[model samples]
Target chain A: MSHHYIKTENLEYSYYGGAKAIDDISFLITHGEKVALVGANGAGKSTLLMLLNALKFAQKGTIDIGNTFVTEKTAKFIRQKVGFIFQNSDNQLFMPTVSDEIAFGPINMGLPKEEVERRTDMALQRVGCESLKNNITSHLSGGQKRSIAIASVLAMEPEILLMDEPSSNLDPFSRRLLINQIKSFTHTCVIATHDLEMVWELCPRSIAISNGKIVFDGLSKELFYNQELLNECHLEQPYLAKIEQMKEAEKIRSAN
Target chain B: MENLDRVISEIRGIETDAIDRGSRYRINPASRIIVCFLFLLSMLTFSVFNIIDTIPYAIIVILLTLLVNIPLSYIFRKTKYLLLFVFFIAAFNPLLDRRPAININGFIISYGWLSFFTIILRGYISVTAAMILILSSGFIPLCRGMEKLKIPKLLVTQLLFVYRYIIVLLEELAQIINSVKARGYGKNKFPVKLWSVFIAQLLIKTYSRAEMINYSMIARGYDGDIKTFSENKWQRSDTVFCIVSILIIGFLRFFRPFVFINNMF
Candidate 1:
């Protein structure tokens, strides 16, 4: 059996004026694998994430999401199978109430009313937001709003979860809570983030993106140790990684 | 504080009945439509014939208004907004007939002020009553009630569609204003020509958006039959609201003959 849940082969795409944004990027993630897409801004990290969810169709190559080939005809099916959490929590939390927002995708899928309610309850409880069932979207704090936003996609029970900058603009406590929530989920998740330290903590496998290309897809330990690679990507080694590097350099000095 | 407290203690619907939170009343939209039309007719009636006897009908109209859960304070406040228009109507009343101030006692009150007051008061009563019926019953239920009351399906459905579409249009309008604000138009009003041009642009966008929405609705299998799944079952509380409403309405309508002078009130 293949370990890959999402497999893309030479996925090429361009925007208006024939400007190539994402060019021939290929990646594979095993089932239940937590992957981090690390990149600076305009590096096509967001674009690739969108392609995986079929939000943006790849014209040149194939994006096989959960074993289904991505196409316009199969757009709805792909969308159902994959949940894409947008970078902006504002865009995701559109519905009036928390429960309704959570159940939006499922309802659009035309699930039975009872089934929708059951799924909503289950998903909300899973995210520890069952107490916020009746509250309106506008009244929620930024963290609570993000949690609810994630819960909305979770309610649909998507096999593959794509979250774009889940930790951005969040307080430390909220970020910790979010990390805890993500850790508990067994779903195959891909988080696009500028938080390199978070990537080190959460993702066992990291993909470094530079100029819309995957520069490195290696073990977490290797990604952390490679300072030159981080420099190339304009990413700094996190505090822990820096400390470890300092200790290693000292060890080399003592040995020499 | 004292006057407001007095007003609070004497709210029209405070003693009526508890509101049915589950919302299960057959609010006949057509009934409200018909009643509002009648209320409008009464405005014409008082204007055409300037008799103080018309005051009774106006008083009855106000009493009917009190039947709904509309607070008396709310009514007083809303009517105050109409006072500017009321001034124009009052101006016309005095000119029609300069009837001399007639009184048995030494109190000489002009018939013009009296007639104008009666006309305006009656107009207020009618308008307020009509508003209560419209607001309390709710636009949706009233439409449904009309449907249940054997209004033609086409008309009922058309009314519902228009009502539902209005929300979308209003949101679109708000969004356009917001975009305009984002581009530095929010803090200040525009020139007349510029405002008109913006409005025209908005109207075009709104029309196209509505058309797109209609297409989306059709794609989503909206075949025009809006089957409501909400449970609007009539309960004991609904019956109580109806009963108390009728009693209060009856009391106010017939209170003229009894003339019970309040001791404390």
Candidate 2:
């Protein structure tokens, strides 16, 4: 069976006469592969994810998700196959309550009421947010809101997940909770994030984007040692890696 | 800033309390709608000088408020600004008409005064009834009630989104205002010249936020239709509540029972 679940060839997008947001980007993800997208501010990581979900149409080139080309006609199908979690949980969670947020996607898909409720309950349970089932979305804390946002998209049961900055502004506990949840997902995942710690822990492969172009794509461990490449991409090694280097320097000093 | 915080707290209080199952107002949203509509309709049907007719309606409002465990003082506080508006609109009634309409004891009551009093009564009843509905039914149930009443689904969805986004807009505005304050902007009396520029920026941010919301919705399978889970069940008590309310309102509107009772003494 083919492993290339998503393939974009020479994809290009410009934002409303502004400079190119995405330029000649091409990549492929195997089935069930977890990849991290790292970049500095103003990089095209978010734009690329949006293009994959067909939230914004590319100005040039093709996007094929699960063998279906993304177009206006096929956008709905493409969206069904690719669930997107936005950077700001507030932006994604507009429903009144946690249960409503979870059921929103399933209900919009025209599922039966019972099925929608079942999926909503299941999703809430999966994220350990079942206690917030009836809580108003606005009253929820930052962590609860993020969990509910993920639950909302997960209720759609998409094959591929495109997450934008999934761990930004979360408390340490919630951040660890999110990492654990991401670790448990078996679906094909592409996460765009500034949190190199999350990238190191969750993704085996890494893709670095800079100025709307791919700067590097390879094994996650290999990318950590490439200081020049990391500096070019405006990223740093994971915190744990930095701690290890500090410990290694102390040992060298002690031995000398 | 205290005023803004107070307003936000009031809204949050309403949102949380409206859905309490222990509250008497937590009846079927559809039944609440029917009663609210009938109450408004019956109150509006009274003659211009039928101030006595609203006595029963006022009693109903008081009873409902007490039964629902909502603070009467809170309702009055919230509606005071609206009462000011209603007062202004009816202020001209007494000046516009001077013809004598009735004699109370030795004094003659002018037709304008009678009508002015009636208008004030009407405004009070209508506004209080609307507030009761809102406080009792909450926003989500009210939308569900509208949906069950055969209102256009699009309009219902718009109402829900508007209610949800208004708080977000307010919060976003608060953030901008805080940033401006940190940067040495105006305090109480803002500069009038900057109003247009500030509003324009707000509009742009609102537009972009709306686009992001729409994109998120679409990604989750929104096909121009928003669907929500409504567990509102219509019980037998809802039917009984609807029937009893209609009959009482019908009596008070048509028979003028308070007037008869007043004459009996």
Candidate 3:
């Protein structure tokens, strides 16, 4: 009896009197599905993610998270369920201390102090950043900041996570750390990233958007090998996919 | 750019040092806040010329600093700029009044000189008390103390936001300045006109970043109200500290012990 955890119908949005950032897009994510959102620059992946979080309301569409519709009345409730991690860790980690940053969401939800503190500890442990509980946010390195940002989102215990460019500015070690954490999550995750390697490893399903339209929607395994569609959407085949291609060529040569 | 870095580092150093000090640092922030506030108010009640009467309050500040394990040298190092600014402001007092007020050891001292010295002493004592408050309570506790004292919630939260973002803004500015230097724009010197442009760009970037942060906050269930984690509570020690400090301030303001000492002499 699994239903769509997140559903959008003909989503369209514009930015401040400019052209449409998201135009005529529709998608549905089932419970516990990790989907990768792939697109070129200005292809509206981020705008769509914001819509899902209800950070921005669509001018001409509807969004539903779980059974609740995303409207003015339900925005607060929806936000508590959909946690968003922004692209820039600097923007996300605004609190003075790491512990405060993690507790902010729960505190805002009107949770009791003990509950908030408990969630903060749990989130820090889950991210393997327990040692940073007392560290100041500004003093942390880039990797530490990213981990704390993720911990902040995780502390809310959200049912769905919307992450924008999670691995964009991270070092390889940090990226691997993040990929493993995302891999362990059972919640519905929709990640908008340029890191196709992350897509290959962490996401089972892939959705590609171009000109604010979903150009491809299928398994990551199928989408990576579709050279024509990857080129059309201005995405490169992931390194692992290229390795797989080389292995196929070797096998053909040995059989010949 | 280096100067900016120095200022930021200095502020950060002061903040960190304030939090990591000794036994007084472990005192309830509310109690420390109440004591420091009473101390400040009692000093303010002294007549500007009643410099001798303020000695007890100054002693209280010194004792508190010692109790907190914040070194006198650290206070002077952090507050020298403010102290110098105060000195310059009080410099004109000595030139304005010419009436001879006191004859000390056959040396005539003008009222102007008397007021000048009084002003300097007042500035030193008051600024020193403020620095000790910062060192003892730290910024977060001070904000919480203000909240407990029934300051407007909006104002208290705004104070916290401003304090947190001041560092963020300074860090952003430092990065931009460093980037400009890295680009070979100005190595040793920054031109005023170029700095103007850089500042304008910084404003735009800050505005956009603030917008993004606002959205992120909304996405995390912030509903125009900020709720803070209440980590401080009133203890028996806090009550004793507050009541005893208030009584002492009342005694100093009313008794004028220095006046009695002068009459005895």
Candidate 4:
């Protein structure tokens, strides 16, 4: 009955013209786990993330979130439990103002006005964007818009979070703030990103996909150390991992 | 490209002014909408060549713009482009009707010219009033007011979505035009022959983007209805504002104040 895990079985999805976006992919992420989904462009990373919350349903497989299955009838319930932050902040934020954007999900879920207000305030505080509550959504800077988009999803209080390129187009300071915010979350998170450095610093596990298939899934260190696999998946070792390797070599050379 | 940027910035400015808390004329959006409706009705009641009667409505718009602290220059600038279209529509009037309608001293004025000016005046006044409504009450609040006033929810929702996405569409267009300009293809004029292709590409891009946006909305629990967070209550002041505005609009429509002034002259 726990609603904190996601399990997919042999999922497949193809666009109308018959190009497969996700081809026979499967993975399991348990409660409170932070898994980084890393892949090159067109590697189906976004498609898989959408599949997790029924934003894009699989044509030939099943996805189970905790004990509940993701189906047409259950998408509404699944969406409540799984919050999605789209790669483009503009697309995710449709409301006019920041407060309205944050309150949208909760309001749709039929929460009381007071509870919605509390959640809105809490989410804004969580993202450190309380000052932008009344600002127009279209007028926000890229970093502020990303933060508000995250806050909007966080207001729903979902048990699982699926973020697609959350740090994309953000400045260094904004990305660091986002990293800290993600690090503070206790919910199970599946982040599809190209920022391997973020993967090293935050997620303990990494899943690398290539050409609609998951090529590697294991500990973050293991993935970073496998240069062959990284190259095959169009990925590079995390900067932190490279630094650690260089430091170890330096220590050995000095000892010799 | 510069024009697009100005438009985008102008929209942002209007949004800011719409939500400004210090404006003295911030009434409930529903009341403001009703007043705007009545104002438009009164202005449209003037027959062709009855340009003098529109003066009172024009004064009301100017006074409201001043009361709301929106500069006259801003309103004028926003309505100028729209007035060009009005000019286009009214341009043929003089050509079609050459019969003289008035003689001021030695100069003769045709009915067509009078009608032309009257049409331009009416267009300017209507566009300015609408701009005032949006400036005084933000677009979202206006839609909510429409909903409260028994406008169909579907139409209101469509209006809200169109308003929200028009910015995105414009941004996309700017990007496309910028890229085209970078390639040195759109210097003097965007090649007329390529317009069809350009429009098709833009449509495709927007359609896909719209699909992605729809998916995001669905993921956030968007059902058929778009629920809002802020609900403005209809205060006693709103009722008073509505009553007084309707009364004034009624007087302007019925009394013919300009004719009395002319008689005195």
DockQ of each: 0.06, 0.75, 0.68, 0.77
Question: Runs in model 3 with CA error above 4 Å?
Answer: A1-4, A249-256, B10-15, B22-24, B185-193, B257-265
- Tens digit of lDDT per residue, candidate 2, span B82-201? 988988988997899888988879799888888888887778778878887888778777888888889998998898778766766676677667767777656655687787777888
Off by over 4 Å in 4: A246-256, B21-23, B88-113, B185-195, B259-265
The better-scoring model by DockQ among 2 and 4 is 4
- Identify the leading candidate in terms of DockQ: 4
Interface RMSD of each: 9.1, 1.5, 1.9, 1.3
* Pairs that clash in candidate 3: none
For model 3, what is the alpha-carbon lDDT of residue A69?
88
CA lDDT of each candidate?
0.69, 0.84, 0.83, 0.88
Candidate rank order under DockQ = 4, 2, 3, 1
Sequence-dependent TM-score of model 4: 0.92
TM-scores for chain A over all candidates: 0.94, 0.93, 0.95, 0.95
Which run of 10 residues does model 1 chain B get worst, by summed lDDT? B13-22
Q: Where in model 2 is the C-alpha error above 4 Å?
A: A2-4, A243-256, B21-26, B185-190, B231-233, B260-265
Instruction: Note the residue pairs that clash in candidate 4.
Output: none
Alpha-carbon deviation at B127 in model 4, angstroms: 1.8
Q: Which run of 10 residues does model 2 chain B get worst, by summed lDDT?
A: B18-27
Best by TM-score: 2
* TM-score, chain B, each candidate: 0.61, 0.89, 0.85, 0.85
Clashing pairs in 1: B29-B142
